[model samples]
Target: MKRIRFVLITLSMLLLAGCGLQNTPEFQPTLQDQISLYCLDHEGNLEMREESGRLQGYCVFTDGSECAEADFFNGVCKAGEIFGEASKRGEIGVLSADEAVEVEVNSGSVDADSGSDEIVLE
Candidate 1:
């Protein structure tokens, strides 16, 4: 009984440790992450949820881990929007720049803003 309990405890610890395992800094950019970017080239509304200057992209990982539906356009991140997390596969953005900056989303919502507001990360 003691051995079984010990094994179970060990397994639980390992699982929790694995879940918490993540790269340090969590602030640097990685290349392997999958990302999608969208830009507002023209001023037309197809009910595409047309917003201006918003970077739309996401970073996907091999293990099916990913940061999806992130937005970035210019040089500023909208409020309640985080770029990504270290624990995540990788951070991706829509309407993102050719290069992604190293940033971790500390808090906030990643939902698309109104048509009036543009999504840009500086």
Candidate 2:
């Protein structure tokens, strides 16, 4: 009887621990709901834009050839080849609404250079 009780108690503890883990907030990468800001390259060129209430952001070369496209939300860029290249070249910036001033992309906070092809916004 004592052994059964011990096993049951152990199982209960494990279940509780699992429940706790499930309740704990996980690191989920979610896009911003609104376009509060847009990201640009170093040359002050627009890297991301919203079209028809959709997020449409991409990277283009001087020759006008699109290299990569990434979703931009709340100043965050996710998944694009050209975006990663631009990021590596230190040519990424974020601009807030009603402000022409460009802000540097935070390397620690931004997931812009992620090579994943997953389109988060649209």
- Which candidate ranks first by lDDT, i.e. highest? 2
lDDT of 2 by residue, 12-114 (tens): 9999998876566866644431222232432223456676598665544344434223333322443222333445334665322334543464443334689
What global local distance difference test value does model 2 have? 0.45
Q: How accurate is candidate 1 locally (lDDT)?
A: 0.40
Model 2 C-alpha RMSD vs. true structure (Å) is: 17.5
Query: What is the TM-score (0 to 1) of candidate 1?
Result: 0.21
In the predicted model 2, the residue pairs found to clash are none
Per-residue CA lDDT of model 1 for 1-122, tens digit only, reads 99999999999999999999786775543432211232222111112222347543543333332233332233233323344442123334432234446657555543365543333543
How many steric overlaps are in each model, in order? 19, 0
Stretches of candidate 2 off by over 4 Å are 23-35, 39-122
| TM-score, model 2 to reference | 0.25
lDDT of each: 0.40, 0.45
